[model samples]
Target: MVVGDASLEIDTVVIGAGPGGYVAAIRAAQLGQSVLIVDKSEWGGVCLNRGCIPSKALISAAHQYETVQNASSMGITMENVKVDYSKVQEFKRGVVSKLTGGVAGLLKGNKVQMFKGEAMFINETEVRVFNDQEAPRYKFKNCIIATGSRPIELKPFPYGGRILSSTEALELPEIPKSLIVIGGGYIGAELSQMFAKFGTKVTIIEGADMVLPGFDKDLTQLVSKNMKKHGFEIFTKAQAQSATQTDKDVTVKFTVDGKEQEVTGDYLLVTVGRRPNTDGELGLDMIGVKMTDRGLIEVDHQGRTSIPHIYAIGDIVPGLALAHKASYEAKVAAEAIAGLPSVVDYKCIPAVCFTDPECSSVGYSEAEAKEKGYNVKVGKFAYVGNGRALSLNAPEGFVKIVADAETGLVLGGQIVGIEASNLISEVALAIENALTLEDIALTIHAHPTLGELVMEAAEVALGHPIHAIVR
Candidate 1:
């Protein structure tokens, strides 16, 4: 292992240390491949260091604070409810540190060599690991590229100072008096509502007609309604034009209904989207690997790239830029390298938005099923009719199940209410395993539980709902 040596060889090399990359590395190692996983950044990458985990931590803290502020409905009373902003950040960092440390331990326990540097392809079978002082060559029998993505920056609002990305917002020193969010996608909607819970005056400007565009409107409507009631000012069909930052505040100029308007806030958070980190020195073209114009690498069912032994997964490849999605692909890619018969399956990949009343969906939406030429029969049961939801004082949304009209097979499911994030997994399993409505309806879900909503939704789809009046 000489510093200047260019002859280090491994059975497999995984680039990036994110969820996808780390999982690929571990799985490949478990299958008896000598693996080396490298990343120039922190161990857990953006999701742990900045995106999902930290954002969720902040959201959880904000939710707790909001609960204390509004506990009168529960006949519980508290005085002088306050949030220590620094403590919240401390808690977030602690959570990240623990998980990242655990990941490192896993890699070490699995005997996966960890390297810290950037990787550029020398050829289909070779990658040069570069650092400030050394350039080491790592030759591999196989390589998996799991380099993720970064937050997309808009020219009109370059991220600096008051105009922040999610990464910066998660580490804000104090709760801003007001926040102007420029996108209403999952990241934007989730963070804006989280801040609103912490008493930040938040305004969201979205280019779409509704927030959480990836979700069905009926589901987003519940979130939109709750956000508005929580004092979030959202302007759909709005496009941000520019931002003027100052020492005290920032003024964001946007357009709505063909009229230009400005909103002043302490900070402006931009979460338009993310671009794959496939640019600048990765050398995909040098290895004759194919990628889209948008820089998303082309991969097959087993996450194999144009160069057969060279594989790609996660945000760098096509599909939803989700942590779970990348991890799923990671398993398939690693198994493929081990000569196992494994391929990626996205039929029941669940997407969850952890807002006030969490929303989750798996498999196809109602419209998606119909478009795919399935005669979809959809039925919904509201939380208002669920005993668990009423007991929890959260009866604001519904669970809808989509099934095949002829076969009664569960096609997909959507939930918009408390614990929706947790509840969607039952539906995901049903769809993934090709379970039918009767399979769920016959399952004895415990009475006075949130999970009954799934059973109830299934019953409604079967036209034999026992809880709610079938409409």
Candidate 2:
């Protein structure tokens, strides 16, 4: 590699052009700062290229297949429906390519310099980016680190042939006959159900008492019920001991309630969790940026690190590993860099799981509100009460609103039903802007729609639900 002696000066340098880094670069450029962004891998990072987009595409295809197979209940019968896994992969790749190309175009349109290389800190305000052919140094007034995270590799189940991580699992060439999932978190559960829909017999081993451990049991139980209907075998509170693989199959040994048991599958997918990419040759420690023992960077409200000129956002920082959260922080960090008074508010960060019936939440739960010493009131409206839900043949969940009994201020919300991902945003916007139960209830939603569920739940909170009985 040819090393350049003189450093190229930039106003702001963003490392890791994932959702966070690219958005930061563009926002900084919009703020009139000369920006440069670099990524060692793909332009859209893991979320767009590997995790979110590809997985969703496959899930969509599987869903269509399942829908067609189950269309008898809707008075439509189909025969001989099949999945072409290769074509599904091609469609996924096409979506990824289009979005990544769009990101590149946006960067160019914003006049942000792009570099494809690995970057490490050389000094306080300088980093050296190295590719296969050249190594160049960059000096910057401010820098944002958004390197993101990777799947945690378990010692007992090292990734290889049949032992796969979420990244590798998404890229499988052919659908396996059977799959054993190690974790029952959102990632594991989503993929498990997706493949189950695709006619793969899936067995989920979860160490927790239930799948999707963070969510309230009512919501997860619905998902678990749907999974069981799709022929998923779940073993909760099971600890995986070891994994052994052959050329054609893999076997995982686990213990349920201290009794040894084993399961064999064509592939073993480990969706345990992800760890921040704060280690390695990044040289964060040498530059004096403070990070927690768990490999998370400590950042202020404006996303500034302990070092004033340096900032960190997204998975590398202390927050949920969410793409939108990273993008939100990216904007605040960029605005702060431009001497604008911008800060992050974690009060209304919504989380969604794209499962069979979909689950989403924002702000707090009823138990959380009561735990925080607020006199809480919960209003819940069942999906069965909605005409649109019955029309769509998906009415197995509910919309719940939690609020202060005294103030009627909306504290939080949880939705579990069809289109929950899209519906949760209304509650999120309400919470973010301090809207109350009355505000949501008074807002006229279209008749016979899923969004009316939110209004009905709010009206339930007000003790006079129009669509459902008060009892």
Candidate 3:
């Protein structure tokens, strides 16, 4: 570590070593730009350390537990079905450690300097990196700010003790007997279901009319059904009034349907949304970086900020707070700094929810396509008709494809079922390359496989679906 006030010169400096920052650093190094990456927290940031990785790990464990217990429908019976949460937590930590370690290895392989400290901007071309032990300064020709966001905390339910955030929710040493979740979005729904599968009674309070307000209601309906099956109590169009916590449990007050109600639980988790990490002592305002009232930095098509040489991406920029989206923008920003003509294309960004039924969407939805002035034709296919779905004993969802009525262009697609996260990528690629419904239909898809669902949906759009009747 460099001590004292000597300023080390670098070609590019990346702030916040999350998915976005590390990727930007590696790409910049690959482009022959000497790069230095710094973060105050973990190397892989929240996604790998506390957010995506750990949550998904627990989700996977919970799913395994559910699958084993519910296998009687498949004529498979097992006794003594149980989940040791301590072992599950150990597995989650192993996954996170492996991934974060990979990030460190990748940075080292790329020859990028890594620093552990908070980075504060001194000017457009300079920043001071410091920790408890020492403070060092760096002068850079270019910089990429990939600082991510944190879970938004409601004032009425400050995170502490029994009041928990997603970070704390994931780190619970043992599963709580009951949990009260304040948001029903992806985070809330995912965590609620994970804990519910672990035998926790979960109650969700959502201000929106439905959970996952961003997704189409039909797609979310299956998820809500599964949540109910797991004994979850959902209160929609509700507001969290306040919360009081005792040493043993927390009680939350809220209102729904013009009636005030209260629920008590071992923990109260608030996951309404996430606020960008663009404020505080980082000194964006001091360096003339223009930001919105919401603290999002305004960026150009290539992720360049108000200052030509300075760039911002990921949660700090104006877009969905997804780690993959940040990675996509990271490459573009790095290439732009390397004098490449790379620009970000958001047309094919896919979003997925790791819920029980696994909902995913890419490009435009049916309503979104129509709102964009496209005459849309939609094709729907149910999983019950698929042999693989039936054989797997998981036939509780469908695939819907939206296309242009006039030109047969594939506009968008939504999937709610098994491996929807993996299935949406093909649709995303189709939308990204401007492929038509005929293109997908013409491709030979193997029989009895989930991929056929996409092909059959395309066939339905073309007015001749072999597997299902066209009404």
Candidate 4:
């Protein structure tokens, strides 16, 4: 330790104040541990500041713009409809700032000490925090690493000038007349659709057979269909080779179906994926914290590493790099550190994508259930058959549920339509609590609501659907 470097003793220390880190710090503090959290950047981390919140803010604006532009069907007409990209960026920034501020207040209210700095583990028991200059040496009884991740930059298309990462794409001073998005993952799809709705001629190049590859083909089809109607171009089975940029535009080269193709656009937004922040200055190796080959920390059920006292969560762990997943593990790790029986559970973790109609899923799908060796019964309810959907004039998606044929236990569910994100939670809860299709079907769902689609699908699974003619 450097001379004159004061030493502070802490019950728990959390690195990276993202959703996972801050939540763990707060939970540990609430559990009567003297918690201290160190973060390098803004309080809310990537999810709140750059990823989830800001993106959603822009998505909401795009939705509003679309709704207003297409209200002629509702006997509403408006002229001179236009989007101001600068104002949109301002709105997104405001949302990010407000939420980040709220997170700061929450940390303070929970009595968790906040340190704005970069932390590197000196060893299993000690960490040195630097904020331009080093802070006091912190000797912690236990530590949680939630450093999260950063966007990966392709070497062939390094982010600069006309090439943009998700972070840079979100902060574009003005919407480009044309944009090419590499990678058809949720981040790419969501931003592509957003820019399309904002009047950009958007093209998405996905290496997979379909965009949003993790989602079911049916869901991706619906999203792709909707995107196509907006004059968006999509290329599947495509490989991005390289990119060259000038002052005003970028030209991307790629190959598809044994043919080389090139596209020139005002900007190229690369949303390939994110890389974990476990390397470099994190110093997990020095502390004997084992990491997997992919650079993610190896942790057990309670988010504990090989080192009993140090734990990891979120993007640093081996599951989906989602904000909610991180927050969930954060609580579990904090509780486990406090001598509670809490352990990480991925059973009912829900994933929601804010596409045009939105997409959400929880637990296993029909294929997953079958792969797990369970005999399955599947029920699918289309939005076109639901009253609330028709009333909303958005009848273009479906709710599908999979259950055990013998036991009627709800195994998993998927949704593609309006409020899918909000609607998927009910099914997640049912699966988490081991509720069955009969339970969901028997429960009275209010009439003329989107949630009724879920109930209708459950009835179909039980072989007694009331709304639509059974197949």
Candidate 5:
């Protein structure tokens, strides 16, 4: 529609108004750049609308349900316990709406231009935004791609009513009487536990030898034990061949440890992994953008793609496919585009699994430290030894600290217990600051708090723990 060359000029253009795109746009605007953001779908993207926020709402509801069921032990008795799935869906929708609205307001408040359409590249310097009625084109000095990823669908089991992806699992009409989850990663483990707590007979089948593969084996063992304790079945070294759906049920066929087995359930969740959403008219190939074997765009530390002015961040790029990581990378890319030096420190990113008793880790694991040729010393303090944990009736897990023996520096930290997700932030901060084990041990932690477990673990590393008997 615009014939004049002056109409297309923009200082910075961002595609896909998810967490990364919106944040980048806002930061660029704040830095006094004329910014424009374009998105094909909702502004908040998958994480705000479907992935992180919605899933956490479901998990929170499930936890409350479990709490009600156990109220008798807390000197409280209830006549009956029940869950209204529709109300849960309403609550999740309300949350997504509020956050998405806030994002829109934020963009407007920052004076960033917003476009609602799919963006495709016409050339290295030009991008075309296609809307239903008309196609508008804009040329920018710099562009950032924040197109996120989608749930990976297994070839053996296509997504349907019986065979569901994580998205569909978040919107269950009713909790299935029995559920089978394929994939032993964090997604599978967390969702399986949530459903089990909601009274669904849950089972997990993983091709790997353990659930939460790539995690510290000890932590994985604790997760497995907790699942078993909650009456969930877990099968490792198992590969699902196919799933057959019928009117009454769905039967999953898999081989476990060279033994053929079949499990039937009301639903099957496919959470093997997620793939980048890089296709759909983006014109990436025309711009000479290099992509990995998995179709993820290759970007530098500052999020610049092969094309000098074009950058990519979030799930469209690499590293951990988490929302917060995306946001951090967006800032770096924005700052770099504004002719400022910005670098993303990948080592400080934290990963958390929101199971009943959460699991979280940051930086190097003990095995990773050893593989890197470091003389690692580990210290572990169980929740059973923590007064707060015992009072809360969730003393099943422990915190493990891995540090350099020579320098007493904290290399990594892992925790598997209640509120472990929030607890891992301190470890991340310590790792980012290069804090030593001795430093953490010397710091005084408040009494009757779960956080004291971190200090206790550091004390154990120093061979002098107060709460538990030192061996």
Candidate 6:
């Protein structure tokens, strides 16, 4: 094998075929630019193959299992209900395979060149992708880095068969009779609830006082209460010191408010957080890419890196580590590469937690609005007051609206109830469009639907809620 001066000419090259990378490639190709996408792993990257799809598939199955277990209370009697762990894994694998295949097909359809290899920045305008058992030199023009991120493993308890990260949690060989989750963030809360619903005695340990630290306290309190109602033991302000794994059980040693405690379980899941995947033989420093203290790539509004021609997006950059956020940023980067003006508006990005009784927020929280020095008026509508929620037998949460008291403009909205994820989009649209609270209240929402909760909340903000008795 010898090196040749064979130059591969391309208008744009994207590194790491995650949601962000593959999307940038397709958009660049659609905009009439020759594009090449390089990925060290599979085509769909972590999100499709490991993170989002796989996790959600397990959550869905767990939800179904819980629903069936509670069916008798809904006037539907059943007996001998059971969950086949292997079957669940099979279904998850099938889901991932279909999605990964879809992504591959899409890249092919767009005529985007795909390379299965690790990519390293050789220079400012070039990247070298190395395939297995091959020399490390494949050239490219204009590269976009979307290498994504990986779960943050705690120092005390490393990942093993009995100790897991979110990735391993999604691939559980068997349901543990008792599971202890470290961290009370969205990942921990969501997975803990899912396992609890599957009859696992679940305990969540968080060094913080609440499950979701950055979320509005009241909203997070509701989530915490719901988790408790589902038989989850939450140990707030608890820190894990170490973990000991044995053949049949694992023991977690921790402290809460200076008091020592221990929790034993069949497995331990560490979901503290995720770190950016910015390391490895990427030659990033050689190319002069600016990075943050946490090893995340620094990028501008248009996804341009320190080196003007190079770009970065997704978890590698600061902001929410969301797949949709990465996809949106990828579009902006691709448009910029095509010599089109593009900028990302972070105001309307929605964040949702897919736990039992989903929690979602967009624009701002009431606390965030106040912190920003805005005179805010808060409105609330409980699911207990909604006819649809009553019929569905999930009348446990509420929808809250925060508006500018002076202008009656919708500042932000948060919903904690069933199907809240879908309902939050209306709030996002309102905030993005700068619509007034009156605008949402005036819109005709269909009867016998959960979305009326949104209308009711808006009306509450206007002091004229129709569904609930006005305070």
Q: Between which residue pairs do clashes occur in model 1? A: none
For each candidate, give its TM-score against the true structure.
Answer: 0.98, 0.99, 0.99, 0.98, 0.96, 0.97
lDDT of 1 at 143: 95
Residue-level lDDT tens digits of model 1 in 1-471: 446555688999999999999999999999999999999998988898989999998899988888788789999999988889999999999999999999999999999999888999888888888788778898899999999999999998999989899889988999998999999999998999988988899999999899999899999998999988988898999978888888999998889998999999999999999999998898888878888989999989999998899999999998889999999999999999999999988888999999878889999899999999999898799999988899888989999999999999999999999999999999999988899999999999998899999999898988888777765
Residue-by-residue lDDT tens digits, candidate 2, 147-238: 99999999999999999999999999999889999999999999989988888999999999999999989999999999999888899999
**Per-residue CA lDDT of candidate 4, range 1-471, in tens?**
346866789999999899999999999999999999999899989999889999999999999999999899888999999888888889999999899999999999999988898898887899988787656689999999999999998899888899999999888888789999999999999999999998899888889999999999998899999999999889999999999899989999999998999999999999999999999887887877888898999999999999999999999889899999999999999999999999887999999999988999999999999999999999899999998898888999999999999999999999999999999999998998999998998888898799999999998888898887786
Residue-wise C-alpha lDDT for candidate 6, range 377-423, written one tens digit per residue: 88899999989898888988899999999998888989988898899
Better of 4 and 6 by TM-score: 4
> What ranges in model 2 sit over 4 Å off?
1-4
Cα error, residue 117 of model 2, in Å, equals 0.7
Lowest summed lDDT over 10 consecutive residues: which window, candidate 5? 1-10
| lDDT of each candidate versus the true structure | 0.92, 0.94, 0.94, 0.92, 0.89, 0.88
In candidate 6, which residue pairs get closer than 3 Å at backbone N, Cα or C atoms, i.e. clash?
A: none
Q: Candidate 5 residues 1-471, lDDT tens each? A: 665443478899999888899999999999899999998789899988878888888888888888888888879899767888889889888888999999999999999999988888889888887788767778789999999999998778999868999989998888889999999898888888888888889889988889998777877788788789888888888889988999878999999877889999999999999999897778898878999998999988899999989999999887888899999999999999988999888987888988767889998999899999999999899999999998887888999999999999898999999999999998898998999998898888899999999999999988888887876
Which 10-residue span in candidate 6 carries the lowest summed lDDT? 132-141
Query: After TM-score superposition, what is the CA distance of residue 193 in candidate 6 from its true location, in Å?
Result: 1.1
Question: For candidate 6, what is the lDDT?
Answer: 0.88
Stretch of 10 with least lDDT, candidate 4:
1-10
Give candidate 6 misplaced runs (Cα > 4 Å). Answer: 1-5, 133-139
C-alpha positional error of residue 389 in candidate 1 after TM-score superposition, expressed in Å:
1.2
**Which scores better on TM-score, 1 or 5?**
1
Candidate number that wins on lDDT, 2 or 5 = 2
